[model samples]
Target: MTSLELQRTNLPEGLEELLGPKGLLTGEEAREYGRDFMGEVDNAPLAVLRPETTEQVAEALRLCTEHGLSVIPQGGRTGLTGAGVPSRPDHEVILCLARMNKVRWLDEKNHAMAVDAGCILADVQKAAADANRLFPLSYGAEGSCQIGGSISTNAGGTAVLRYGNTRDLILGLEVVLADGTVLDMMRALRKDNTGIDLKQLFIGSEGILGVVTGAVLKLYPAVAERECALLAFPSLPAVMKSFAIARESTNDRLSAFEMMPQNGITLACNRVPDVVDPVEGDYPWYALLEVSASKEGSGLFEMLEGLIERLMEEGLVVDGTVSSNEGQRAQLWRIREALVEAHNDMPHLLKHDVSVPISDMADFIETAIEKVQAIAPDAMLIAFGHVGDGNVHFNICHDLDTPDGSLATRHKEVTWAVYDLVQEYRGSFSAEHGVGSMKRDALRRYRSEAELAVMEKLKTALDPQGLLNPGKVI
Candidate 1:
């Protein structure tokens, strides 16, 4: 018998009703569910089951647990880390939550939204906007990435400068344990210091211990006034000075503070059509800055103009343009996001989603970049990210003409070099992205023996039989 035949477990009565033919994917259909976002993993699963309801998920997990079958939880399949990917062909099955995407409620009064684990991130953002609020978990994969995986990763994005990461925004969660026990703790109130904050455990755990079926997400007040500007700086120091001036002058109105190397802009213009270099002359560094005000008491244009005036007076910003309208604002933001697509087109790009203390960010980048250039001279370091949050999208992209993923292996070697510096500086290897199988060995290597042991103990305690997202995180 095949692994599928051997893996079949007795299901509870009336359990299969939640899935249609397409939902219960098997055999050849199960082939694609084994891997993840980066195409790093190569495991092919035995079965790919998609259940449309939380009840079905519980039932499936119950059976899988009882039979000692490992079940992998998947989201949009867009995660760079292989958190959602299956590790084994025969012993593992994929439980895709794509269909249980119903938004249970949007409590605008409490500034909270409750949604199913399967709901797409972009859709959740739209749902919040329609309710005249802001659900600020966003990134490149917002259009397809699910909330569950994003939560598991504790994703940080562009707006982290102001809104914070997935870890900070979540209020409550409804998680189904490895043994299929449903823990519905989806409360909206924020000040419940009553007992331990149980939901925080599942937030960044990468689904190793349990499956998140639903969530209660915190929301922010709608932005009333907004201003965006792209400023050119002669050096990283100048950019840092301008950022400090803006933070002091704007009085926390600053929404985003993004740092980009000049070559990244050039690459974006060349590889991606309709993407233009915003500045007139070549500057070494650029800052894509946006500030939003909630009450509309202060005019965004006035705030931006004042900040830029001080910046220019101090010789921080060499050349800058404040957006006169919304279209221009979007164009500036587009450059930041579209630049990544162009960077992807460039061959031999080693990507690092890492963060350090804000105070240490500038020096860290300078030293890291210098170290990298010493090794790969022609190595174009196209850096950009939410610098205010100390999260840098430190990308080392080789020439774009040679488009091949094979050369990215060399980039991996360079990653070790950078990660070594990170450890020395007390920075993290995986910052925004969680440790899936892709970084599991690194995690084991870097994390203390005591920490790893504790993690494993917790994993074993929560998933005694090791049936839930096996071979991930720990």
Candidate 2:
């Protein structure tokens, strides 16, 4: 037998029987779980373990630990980072929680819901909506991304301006340590001042510390009224100024304030079907503003109209359009989604999910654009993101007509220039995306030695064997 076949056959004895045939996947079936959502890392694992319950996960971990095998905990595998896949071929096993998908309970009175880590984010949102509550953690991948993976990455979507990141939405977690010890800290209370917040450790740890089996997520009152507007800005400064005025005048109803560049909108309108620019005139920048209220008849539509008129009069907004209904609102939002889809297949695209202080957003973008132009003048910059939270998806790629491999040589140089500027502004290199194997170098380069030491100490304390998602995060 070949070495890979030998390794596959050496899987922890009785594992197949313990998990049954359907739960333990090998050969071609196992390779399907080896890659990430981005198809960036495609290392085949020895086996793929699909556990149906928390106990099954714990027992599997115990067996894997006994056999001195490393385990990679995976969720919906919709993460842009390579955190949910095996990093080495035939050297590890994937412990996918997809089969444990279940909505355990929902407490409308308490404004909380218990769910299996494998539960789809959209399903959880629907469950909360059925209870007349709102689970506002939303994004493009909500249709496929699992709740556990969102928690693991501390995902920040467009709604982060009003709600918060996934870390804030989670009230409790149920984690299985490397050695199979179950830490059940699944409390739904909002105010728990008991000792240390143990769940926080694994929130953005990316499965390096442990595997999350379940979660208790916080919910909010359902939005009764909402108003959306697509506003055009003559300059980046105008966009930021309008954002400030809108936030202050909206009576705390401003849920989303997203910034989209002209290039991104143009690409979306040209490439994505039914995704057209909402406003006339070729403005340099655009902002998608959404205001929502829990109380019915909150006059949000009138409020947004008045806000737009004032901004226009002040020259902060050059052109604008408001959504009169849900369909119109969805059409406006489609521009943002379409921008992402438009360039997904582009060659040698370098995506940077970095965040800086909100005050320095416009200046950072302007200066970064200049620096990037200096590196590759022909590169197309598709910079857009949640301006309210200061997270910029500063993606760069070669011009459409350029050759496929043109930007391959300067990819590292372009990325380092952007990240170095982020560091100078006291910003995070990897903001919403966790430090997977891809960003391990950035983590080491950006983080201080003392900070890394503490992280290493925690990893040693929790996963001393270093057999849980090895070569990831720290």
Please give each candidate's TM-score. 0.94, 0.98
Once model 1 is optimally superposed onto the true structure by TM-score, how far is the C-alpha of residue 409 displaced, in angstroms? 7.2
Model 1 scores worst on lDDT over the 10 consecutive residues at: 6-15
- The models' CA-based lDDT, in order, is 0.83, 0.92
Per-residue accuracy of model 2 over 1-474 as CA lDDT, tens digit each: 975467658799878888888899888888889988889999999999999999999999999999999999998888887988988888899999888889999999999999999999999999999999999999999999899999999999989999999999999999999899999999999999989999999998999999999999999999988999999999998998898899899999999999999999998998888888978889999999999999999999889999999999998999989999999999999998999999888778899999999889999999999998888888889889998898899999976788754357889999999999999999999889888999989999999999999999999999889999998998
Model 1: C-alpha RMSD to truth?
Answer: 2.5
> Every model's Cα RMSD, please?
2.5, 1.3
Query: Using TM-score as the measure, which candidate wins?
Result: 2
Model 1 has an lDDT value of 0.83
Mind sharing the TM-score for model 1?
0.94
